[model samples]
Target: MSIPRDTRATVTEFLDRLAAGDPDRVAELFAEPVDWQLSWPDEGHPAIPWIRPRSTRAEVADHFRALAEHHVPERNATTVSAIVVEGGNAVLLGRIGQTARATGRSYTAMFALHLTVENGLITRYHIYEDSLSVAAALTAAPTG
Candidate 1:
């Protein structure tokens, strides 16, 4: 579906800020008391459990900051392949491939960001990705 011009612009600008690794800009895209939900398939269970919760901009910033400190890669390296907007919601498909600075381990994974915007600011964000791929990338091989 075609997105409204204003919504499209807002989504694009928000993504640009995130890809640029500008935390302040990212925060600006979000409304106060934003809701953030991140989910992945469970590693050791039959059920595909989903992790859902709400968070504020400051909380989201801390999460991103931790990732940045662990991964120390080029800020603009993330690639957004597509964006589909429906009503007040937009879904962004993207991926990041980089080597972690702390462990010098290479990692690549795909991601989907589901966002809800209101009044030109994001109110909700739901992120989905491959948990196993992320775990493999982040964890060091067992030293026996």
Candidate 2:
């Protein structure tokens, strides 16, 4: 099934803004008090600084900022293989490769992102990723 025009547009804009690596611009596409959810334990893993609760658009920007700070910009890569849309929802299936700056370890993980848009703004942002791989990469000892 085809996606609605407005939802498709919003998703496209979000992808563009995310690619540009502008946290503020990326957050601009989201509505205030977004329903943010990530696939991780509730104990709040301290290894990954970006893993935190985000509600407001400003917090959304902060999430991206923290992510950028912890990961190597030159080594990070994201590939979206598919996007399935229905009504106001869209799910992006992709793989992400990232290198931890401190540990200098790299990990590749498959990810699925579910987004829900309302009135041209994203109201929900839920991501399911290989958190174990990411955590290992971030916390592992740096190799010589």
Best by TM-score: 2
After superposing candidate 1, which stretches have Cα over 4 Å from the reference? Answer: 1-5, 40-54, 141-144
Native-vs-model 2 lDDT? 0.90
Show the colliding residue pairs in model 2: none
The Cα local distance difference test for each model comes to 0.68, 0.90
In angstroms, the error of model 1 at 124 is: 1.2
* TM-score of each model, in listed order: 0.77, 0.94
lDDT of 2 at 136: 95
> Candidate 2: which stretches are off by over 4 Å?
1-5
Weakest lDDT window of 10 consecutive positions for candidate 1: 42-51
TM-score of predicted model 1? 0.77
